[model samples]
Target: MRETPSTPAPRPIVGMVGAGQLARMGWQAAISLDIGLVCLGSAGDAAARAGAPLMEGSGRDGAALARLAAGSQVLTFEHELVDLAALGRLEAQGVVARPSAAVLSLAADKLRQRRTLDTLTGVEVPAFTPVTSIGELEEFAAAHGWPLVLKARSGGYDGRGVWICDDGRAAGQAFAEAAAAGLELYAEQAIDLAGEAAVLVARSPSGEVAVYPAVSTYQRDGMCRWVTLPASLPDGLDKKIGRLARTLAEETQLEGLMAVELFLTREGGLLVNELALRTHNTGHIHTEAAVTSQFEQHLRAVLDLPLGLTSPVVPAAAMVNIVGPADGSDPATRLAAALAVPGAHVHLYGKGARPGRKLGHVTVCAQTSEEALALAQEAADRLEGNG
Candidate 1:
């Protein structure tokens, strides 16, 4: 009798630093790839609730991070809230962390990113300066004009640490508040008119890279509400955007995913808004549109696996976030209705209801961008009890 050959074990048990919806989506991709995913978050986190392996703890806890890494082949990240310094310590102790501390610094520190991009040609950053006092704020406003933006140097997300000031008195007050929060602040010349967009790119340790099509993102209150494929950019802008994304991926020696947000001005110029060094919200539309989702691409990049195709398989697709309803009801209650929409793929995070919080998202694929976006919006509205 011939004995059956032994099955090879799955390589690269990934330890992700957060258990939010991003981790949950990554865990789903890991399942398809036959990989292990251990996320660091409480039992109540979306990934944890979905049965993803996890270490019960906070991302900021160094001890917890070590515990999570002890059993995994490589450590990665789902969000920027993790302690960067702790990651540096882990690297010193010989734990493998992809998009290393140095790479993380390039994206995690807002001011550093601005300064770094400022040196690169073909990339426009809004005029900015680190503001230390009210005097600095005034000086910047005088140079750049009123209605400038004040942003925290680091450690802020989802529009939490940004202020738009229209006058010296308001700018001074905003400066004082930032000082009281102990935040290092920077003042930026606000770009007026037009919309926003994001270009998602991924690079592997082996130097392989993938660039996805740029998408138009709609934002409200500085929080992204939806993203649509086939963005309405000017002639020749698509090629330019793709080239820029490729340059950043190759030049930075990026070993993970990066979503380069851009400010598309009415003047027809593109400005680099920010970079997210891991799987970003803007890529959620890829779940239904792209041949390979950003979650899987990021995993492949960090693990040095051959990267997957990043091409969009559908003609058009859009992702609409289901912000919590004012009535504070769970999307689960409206799931059946959302799923009834043709071509709508709904993903609900098992999270508690909270006003303005993103509880889930819906992605739709159709023959045109308008149809995809409209269907996605309808599904999301149904889920949020607005339809």
Candidate 2:
């Protein structure tokens, strides 16, 4: 057996690729443990404003990643968009990449995810067909019916890189555009469902698991607007969902956080839609509502430590995303107004404000789901200049 290097003289530092808000807030978590949270950020990135040791470069740069990897105990990522080839290079050079390249690769490509989900015996996924050309798309649509969703086999997220085709003509047009842009496309039947739900699960290196309450997401233009935890589903559905979530984490051999996005059909059944192998937008409410936040759980799992308790701190909680406008005033005033509400916790991701950009989130806790949702909505409204 190969001997590992001795622990650093004092606290261990963890290097994170992509210094977005995730890395910024992770810095807060690292502070409590006195661990250095190093970030590989582009020059002048918003997270650089947080004062962490920022390695200015692209995550795809092997030299940059190596520089960040040196002296770090573990390496992880804030965003999945990081170049997997670079991570594989790092792994070849003996750097530790939590969740492993094998697992992350499955989450990186939508086509691979769909195939893997299909291979799993008990997992239920939406009916999907891969389309590489206009003819295939037309045939799939004709067979499956119209008004289908066209999704890029890779890189689709938060409403970006997704399109809906109402007819064969629209599908052919989308195919032309996608082909011209060198994009891979897939077709899926657009089910008439109640809404979307997400369940967050974390697994330690030793296989211990913790599952958070399942939440329903409200989306507009494919961007999540709000998340309500402990979703009002039929009795025993929560437990079943929790079991399925754990099964995914274990099957993936995941070491850290994973969010399973699902479609909750009107018939009271859940179909897994996608998986995010990182801390997720829908799980942000766990920061204030759960006894152990998902961020901390991620840290613990990635470090190969024991799992934390995942019980809810309140009966119900809701999280609303703060999206900025094309023309808006400084966010400080709006943040202050939202903070004025009791039981409302605001987390601002320090980033340049762009139309439809996720600036931050407000999480609220209350005795019931409705009250918590109202509080979260008020906070979002205040942040969006509705005050």
Candidate 3:
């Protein structure tokens, strides 16, 4: 008699820390892959709103992390603000945290990331120095020139924890504020920026890698507002940026998605600005524009599965962030109007409206970047009651 075959084991679950918009999108991708996503989010987070299974605690809590780990095969993150040392301990205890605690720690500290990348060949970073006190900031400014940029080495994002000081008095104020907040500060020479661009790359634990095209990012008030795919770069610049992203991924031993934000200097050279080790706002357009969305690619990478093609299905695509209006009215009230824009794809993070808060995003794909941008921006504006 022939022996009967046993049933296959269920797909492994991915435990994502911080159930923000990125985690919500990742959970959607997990659904299509027949995998599970256990989100360690607080009450009413985007992922929780999306009905993902919740671990229901702060990501910084060690016990919550352990519980999440116990029920999942892989641990990942939607945000990098976790307690790295505790996560490192979890890794020691056999939890598979893709991108690793070591990588997360390095990326979490801007000073460390800057120093490490500065030493890498073919990587250009703006001159930067650690600033511990007002005097140190002054000293760096004296050397680098006034109007320098000061950034907190940790806990800075979306324009917070960053300051521009044109004189000693301003530097002193910034230093005092940072000191009171217990933040590590660093000074950087502000580059004459032509524009900002970013490349999203995914690397699997098995050493497979895929890279998306570099995209132009437009910032307003230090937060990303719009991003256009196939950033108009000088000839050969795209390939050069692609190589840089791949090199960084290999050097970092990245096990999931990494977004390399680069500065296109006025001097016609590319400089590294920052690195994000998870899904990022820069790749938001990939959801409707590319063959494989960044969220899906991240899941595949973390699972050590075959990476997906990173090609654009359309000639051009653009993403526009929907910031909360000044009056703080809910954009959801205008959701129907936004959805009416032809070829526009809208994604709203389940959150209450607040001034300048990232409430959602709209993406549009078309034959030209100009058309995509116009449509995406129009749709985003409608969502915020600006159109």
Candidate 4:
């Protein structure tokens, strides 16, 4: 882990799991509060290296989590991919888990999440069929048509654990491999969605709610590459999307950050895409552009503090993810160049560089979305050695 620069003063302690860039940014916020932010991280997570006091271990390791949580006033997560079983054990021992056990379970399992909305909440979902075998998928494909999407029920993000299948045979083979590994698989009719959008909301344990302006998300093959503040849709659709998000948060009684992803079908109707119960990739731009960064909002919500404003400080802001090239070069090396640009900021996650892996992100705030986008692209280009 990177050594922490000297702190001006000590602060209250907040324990966070998964020392990714999200947690790293949270450390920046904690600095102002003079609060000590301790991270439970892998050996060299980028955030962990950038100076949060790291409990070097896996979140899945019960002993390690216990050690990390021992002296914290409150606990929250930067990433949702924690060992829930271990967290549940700590909860049983009377430790508070913001977003709570029930909510976390839903966010972690796509199948459970779909069932929660489709069957329990009466939300309209695209016709979906579960696949436990190649035979089942073949049957589903025959019924639903070709080019269907097969999604793993758990542990998938940024285009991973998802496949677009064009034939029964392909579906069968994928289904067989997925099923053999005990991973639940499901198929959905590929809708002609206009695009994607997300609403990032924070809820305190005291039930205070603050919703950010709904944002438009751009994805390349399921990996979100750019997010625009304030989606370009009309007011009516924005209201509908916001209402859908609030409904889910109220229903789940979620405390802390919740990002509700949605799809605008070609017919102009909005459909629920997915839900993330922690800080989200889509909300990264909020860190510098919004009055209250999502990282602080997560802390405030979990600690039951008053929620902060979600208004953007600038007129427009865009966030572009930095994915690594085939050849590995230190992403941090590009930060100097990115910083040289006006209104440009870069966040690098300390992880081994890999093709398609998000190494970090750049957020640029400008007078217009296009301007912000151009700056973001410039930063991305430099980060990827394109320039």
Query: lDDT tens digits, residues 179-220, model 3?
Result: 899988899998888999999999999999999999999988
Model 2 lDDT on a 0 to 1 scale? 0.84
- Index of the highest-TM-score prediction: 3
For candidate 4, the clash count comes to 3
**Clashes in each model (backbone N, CA, C under 3 Å)?**
0, 0, 0, 3
lDDT of 1 by residue, 307-376 (tens): 9898899999899999988878887898999999998999898899898998889999999889999999
| Model 2 CA deviation exceeding 4 Å by range | 1-9
Predictions: Cα RMSD each: 1.7, 4.6, 2.6, 4.3
Better of 1 and 4 by TM-score: 1
The C-alpha TM-scores of every prediction are: 0.96, 0.94, 0.96, 0.92
lDDT of 4: 0.82
Give Cα-based local distance difference scores for all models: 0.89, 0.84, 0.91, 0.82
Model 4 vs. true fold: TM: 0.92
Give lDDT tens digits, candidate 4, residues 1-387.
Answer: 999898666455788887887888888888876677888886578777787788887767878778877878777777667678888888899878787767888878887888787863635666677777677777777787888989998888887888888777777777777777777888887778788889999888888888888889999989999998768786598877767777787888988899988887888877787888888999998987899988888888888888999988999989999998778776667778877777788887777788778889999998888899899988888888775
In model 4, state the lDDT of residue 118.
84
Model 3: residues with Cα > 4 Å off, grouped in runs: 1-9
Clashing pairs in 1: none
Q: What lDDT does model 3 reach?
A: 0.91
After TM-score superposition, what is the CA distance of residue 162 in candidate 2 from its true location, in Å?
Answer: 1.4
Candidate 4 ranges with C-alpha deviation above 4 Å: 1-11, 120-122, 180-182
